[model samples]
Target: MNKNRVRLRCTYHGCELKQTGGIPYLAPYFDPLLQLLNIEVLDSSNHWKLFSKHALVHYGKQFARLGKLKRNDVIELTAQLRKDGSFVYPAHVRLLTNGPRREKIPESRTELIGYVMTQNGLYHLGGKYEYPHYVNQYENWLNKKDSTADQSKAESSSITPNQSYCHHHYGTHGNEKKGEK
Candidate 1:
């Protein structure tokens, strides 16, 4: 057996049976593009995934050091086996990025990008998570402003007194009655 090949033990309660036929595991990392945890895999069909506890500790430390993983940071996967003859891969991992930036926006939003590790290979997490981009937010703000302006115009027009109706029906043009009739 190749020393690098992951070793596994039978997961029966009170029954300690080491097995060599277990599946490989690949840990996942944060993917900014997908805005979720993604795993890179050498082969997805191999049933490779992450070890939960290891992933948590690894990402916890990473988050502390880097603040948050944005997208495209390289993440490595570790393996683990369960007692029910099943497996649980890492569902989450830390965000590793180039560096942190203090955004100019008043809300203090930032962006980070990193890579995700999978059983197949390392994959790049895209720029979907970069904060302070503001394109979407700006569009929404503009739309609201336009809507409010339209509403104000409509309200002003509707609130005007019925001067035209009074003049045509009752000839009530305040001191100009003789000429108007």
Candidate 2:
């Protein structure tokens, strides 16, 4: 709803931390004290239990985004954030190692299984070997489908009743009904 509102975004999943909003940005003051509680990682379920249930209800599948962050990184980031009076934990702030960066497997040996990734670069006889963002493609396809449906609905409504019946008889696939006159 509020696109301009800055959120505590995850550097990994690129989603925001929902459980931390609504209250004052008090995590900075208290997150340091949490180390005393023996809560090592903010991602731990036990660590999350410290917050009230109502605060965490709308989190959906979002975790604390702490997996890629160290305890020191959290403390430092929180401390720096409080100074600026901003809760927006942006994606670019890299204080912790995201993990060992592995070199991409050479494209020469890799093959795609219809937008499905296969381990060891498994190759099928007729499969396209290109790596693609299938999820984005799927979302685009859904948008296209919805747009076309709306256009077709509008067109059908504007057409004569007889024309609408004929259009349905010979569908998009050019397959006519078995008993069509």
Candidate 3:
């Protein structure tokens, strides 16, 4: 019954959440709980931005499926991220975790090219591209798709080098070649 930890079917943040209604209580506890896990805060400068870097990294983005990313979930997900990571916005966290049975949360293709939420407040994560590699990857993927499609077309077109041969590959008729009937 810690006033700090938001619980399932419990009221916190002045929001009355009922059980059957399936409201996510763990949503709000994510940040405060994450802080308790790590030893010290890394960089106080634009905390949320730094956290976004961690959260959107390989693991964080995966767990951003609502309820699935609970306080404990965030604790494990970040295992490294900290300093009041979840203190940003419970709704935003829900956008990431969304959990099971809740509306399935969609992964974003939008580059992390904007401000991100954190414990202290909003912070810029990918000033232009945080790491900038994702954009390259997406571009590479598009290229590969285009190349594969071109190759497929080339292969299909080459099926018959001689158009006449392809169209007149006559089958046997009454044990004799075509026109012998």
As a TM-score, model 2 comes out at 0.19
Which lDDT tens digits does candidate 2 get at residues 38-151? 112133242322221111111111122232223233211221123223233223322243455322211111111111233223222365423233223434544665888799
In terms of lDDT, the poorest run of 10 residues in model 1 is 9-18
- Best candidate, lDDT-wise? 1
**Predictions in order: lDDT:** 0.33, 0.29, 0.31
Residue 144 shift from truth in candidate 2, angstroms: 0.6
- Model 1: lDDT equals 0.33
Q: How far is candidate 2 from the true structure (C-alpha RMSD, Å)?
A: 19.6
Ranking, TM-score, top scorer first: 3, 2, 1
**C-alpha RMSD for every candidate:** 21.0, 19.6, 18.5
lDDT of 3 by residue, 77-126 (tens): 22332355433222222232235564222233322111112212322255
Runs in model 1 deviating more than 4 A are 1-133, 161-181
* Cα lDDT tens digits for candidate 1, 62-119: 2323332333454443334354433344333333333555121111111122222221
- In candidate 3, position 177 carries an lDDT of 50
Best by TM-score, which number? Answer: 3
lDDT, residue 153, model 3: 92
lDDT of 3 at 103: 28
Q: Is candidate 2 or candidate 3 better by TM-score?
A: 3
Q: How well does each candidate superpose onto the true structure, as a TM-score?
A: 0.19, 0.19, 0.22
